[model samples]
Target: MTHVAIIGGGPGGYEAALVAAQLGAQVTLVDSDGIGGSAVLTDCVPSKTLIATAEVMADLEVADELGITVHDAEGDVAKRTTVDLGKVNRRVLSLARAQSHDIAERLDRDGIRRVAGRGRLDGTRSVVATLDDGSEERIEADTVLVATGAAPRTLPTAQPDGERILTWEQVYDLEERPEHLIVVGSGVTGAEFAGAYNALGLEVTLVSSRDRVLPGEDPDAAEVLEEVFKRRGMTVLGKSRMASVTRDGDRVTVALEDGREVVGSHCLLALGSVPNTADMGLEEAGVTLGKGGFIEVDRVSRTSVQGVYAAGDCTGVFMLASVAAMQGRIAMWHALGDAVSPLDLSIVSSNVFTAPEIATVGCSQKAVDEGEIEVEQVMLPLATNARAKMQGVQEGFVKMFCRPGTGIVVGGVVVAPRASELIHALSIAVAEKLTVDDLALTFTVYPSMSGSVAEAARRLHHVR
Candidate 1:
């Protein structure tokens, strides 16, 4: 029987542990944090939960435009706007903790041993874990999986005290709503948080080093988001990089690279993530690391060392939970000598949980624009969409990319509420290698947001 030791309890580690255990491998999971890792307990779940409240706030704000009115308890016009940050924080933390406990319970039920500690590899086949009680336990394993996830990268100038200048994960602990939020970095995380906080009635300023928001996403999508943010009364400072963040009594000031300054109640550093690959004896084991400090892994999730593997954010392969889970499963399958296929990123769908969520899969406009891929593209505005018009949604678009010759649907992007759910169909099509003709023939309900998706695919049918 193979004994497997999995490091980190994030999506990658837990998923791999489950698969290995089911494959009859004795698995021991070592985690310094909670069972669900940062993705569940801190970053992804908490932020999305907070965004849920922000979404409700956004809907209420738009109710007046939708010919809807609410009366207060006294039967007068509803003129009050308030946010119970305490309640919101309570609910968010409660949900996160519940989910974490559920995961831990499931792992225990599956017969996988969970060790609460920081783990380090002593050798190729041995792991040493320092327990919470200051005791160290060494375990021998036939295989070791390093899923140690990443953390938010902080700047020397803009340090996170975890109170005022915070990381994305730390903001969930706030008892009071920020009067103004200055989010540094205009990447996906930064943009999403900025949009969410703006929806929640905080004066938001998105400081970006680039000329536009979402610098790495589709240009068209970024353009649309920038426009929407402006319309929503957000202050977007382009080409404005954060030099440092300083707190003065109650107010926090962000000094920009260009000498311009902005003040806010709190500042968030959404700069980027650094892989948790340090002090793990990876160097001694001869496991290679990439230039960016992530583990060097192939599609099969194998590091350079024998009987060892790595996955998730540590592998630097998209840093998404879904992708991490897939990679973990694949690693287990391969290690157990079962039927295994290499990781395929082509059809993997991802989403930014912003106000108008950005969900996408397969090829992108940047790829097409750079002539990296030969594809025909079609972009359809949600304002013209029947369901969108009826729902008073004026900002969003569904864009599709197809093979120019065969009209095979290669990729797509959806920017609107619940786009995350809607993109699954597109993901299936891309993964199944279905053509635009196939998508056009598929039935989508009329007077629905998804109708725009079908129509966008249908329009790509004529590009040949």
Candidate 2:
């Protein structure tokens, strides 16, 4: 039987370990942290769990806007509601830890051995794991999968103290709610947390070096998010680059490059992530790294060295958990000599988890702007939808892009509550290369938010 060693117990490593084990390989999974990786134990799952509670708070706050009467503690009429932060944080952390434990259990049941320690490569086929008890073990493997993943990037000027200044991962340890949350980035993670905290009744200020929030996303989506954030009382400081962060007593302050200062109870740096590829013997094994220290891998997740492969965040792919999972599966199938297909990013749908979440797939407006793809487009506002009006959703839209002659959907965007789930239909359409007419012809339930998606597709039929 072939022996396989997978490093980092996140989605990529754990998923590949299971697949390799099922393929009759003896698998050993090594992780310095808990299973489920950063995505589960810290980032994606925990953040989204927190957002769920914030979403509920948003609904409660909007009751007054919907012309529904709300009562205050003294039994007087109230407009907006307050949030219990401690309760929300507890729920978020509880779910995250439970998920981590469950994944570890599943791996153990699969007969995969788990080594809790830092794992490094001695060679292409030899893995050296330093255990928590300070012992070391060398395991020989025919195939090695590297899924070491990434961590939140910190700068020398604004390093997190894990107290006042915080990374996204460190925010869960917060017991008391932030009086004012000064978020220092306008990327997806920053935007999501900013929106969530704003909805949860915190004084929120989102600092953006770009013109608006979600600068990396579709322009239309970004514009809508900015408008919504402003409407919700979030002070968006645009075109403002942060120079440094400092703390005074209990309050924190962010110094801007333009000589302005913003202060808050706490600050979160959602700058970006750096791949965990250093000192892992990647160079010794002849595995190459890209310009940014990302493991250089092909579509099949093969590294430069033979019998060595890498996947997930470490490979510097799209950096989504879904993409990571797909990459892991592809790696296993390719390495095991099974029927395998190369990674297809064309139809890989992605979403930014914010209030009125943004979801998109395929050809983007940026691609079109750069003269990379020729396409027709249509955009429709959700405010006009019957269901949206009833639900008091006044912000958001659905947009579609398609080839002019073929009418096949190349890409699309959905901006609304639960856009993450609504984007799946569009994802399917893009994946199947279905035309606008095909989507328009499909039946959508009336008085539903999804009907707006079909209407957007229908508008493409009348485009000039």
Candidate 3:
């Protein structure tokens, strides 16, 4: 049987281990964090759990409009609810730990050896793990999969103190809710946290270097989210680049590049990520690294060195957990002599976890605008949908893009509550190369957010 050594233990690493084990390969997974890595132990699972709590708080804000009244012990109407940060954080951590344990159990059942250590490439086909007990173990493998993932990018002028100033991962340790939260960077991570805190009834200031939040997402979706944020009393500082962050006693002040300063009780830096590829002996093993120390891997997740594969954030792919897992699986399948398809990034679905979440698949408006791909498009407002109206959702829309003549659905975007769920249909359409007419003809439940997806496709079909 082939022997496979996987490093990192994130979605990419663990998923590959599972696949390799199932394919009759002896798999060894080396991890510094828990089996689930940062995605479960620190980042994705924790943040999404926090957002779920924030969603509840946001939903309560419109309870009265839905004819639901909440009252206190004295039978008096309660104007607002309070957020218990301590409880919320405990729950988040508990959920994260539970998920990590679950992943560990799964790995155990699959007979994949799990090592708690930091792994580095000893050579092209060897992994040296430095265990917590100060012992080192060397393992020989036919294939090595590196999925070390990424860390929060920090600036020299703005270092995270982990108290007054924080990274996305450190936010779960906050025992008290910040009175005024200042989030630097308008990327997906920053926007999600800013919106979550605002929904939880905190004064939030989002510092954006770009003209709007989510500069990388759909323009219309970003615009709608910005509007919703502003409407919910979030202070958005556009075109304001943060130069430095300094803490004074209990307050933290963010200095902008343009000579402006904003002070808050707490600050969060979400300025993207840096791959965790350094000191891993990758270059020594003949692995190629690109700018920002990201491992250079092809669609099949193969590194420059033969039998060396890299996946996840370390590879500088889409940075989504799903993409990372898919890459890892592809690597194992290809290395194990199984038929596999190279990754096609265009069909991948991604979502930003904010109020009125933004989800997208396949071609984007930016591509169309850049003349990268010509396509017919149609955007349908969710407000016109019967279910959206019933749910009192006034913001968001579904947009679809298809080839001009063939009408094949190329891309789509959904900005609505649970947009993540609604994007799956469009993702399938894009992945299968289903035409707009095909999507339009598909049955959809009435009075549903998914109906807007079909409606947009139906409209695109007619526009052709």
Report the number of the highest-lDDT candidate.
3
lDDT of 1 by residue, 1-464 (tens): 99999999999999999999999999999999898899899888898998999888777756767887754666333246677788888999999999999999999999999999999888798999999999999989988999998999998998899899999988888999888999999999999899888887788999999999998887887888899899888999999988899998779999998899999999999999999999988888889998778999999999999889998999898899888888888989999998998999998999988878889999988888888999888888898888887777868999988887888789999999899999998999899888887888889898899988888888877544
User: What TM-score does prediction 2 earn?
Assistant: 0.96
Worst 10 residues of 1 by lDDT: 70-79
Give model 1's TM-score versus the native structure.
Answer: 0.96
- lDDT by candidate, in order shown: 0.89, 0.90, 0.93
The list of candidate 3 runs beyond 4 A from truth reads 70-79, 462-464
All candidates: TM-score:
0.96, 0.96, 0.97
Q: Alpha carbon lDDT of residue 124, candidate 1?
A: 91
Q: If both were scored by lDDT, which would come out higher, candidate 2 or candidate 3?
A: 3
What does candidate 3's lDDT look like per residue over 90-208, in tens digits? 99999999999999999999999989899999989999999999999999999999999999999999999999999998999999989899999999999999999998888999999
Tell me how many clashing residue pairs each candidate has. 0, 0, 0
Q: Which ranges of candidate 2 are over 4 A from the true structure?
A: 65-67, 71-80, 462-464
Compared with the true structure, what per-residue lDDT tens digits does model 2 show for residues 264-342? 9999998999999999999988999997899999999999999898989999988999888888878888988888889
Best by TM-score: 3
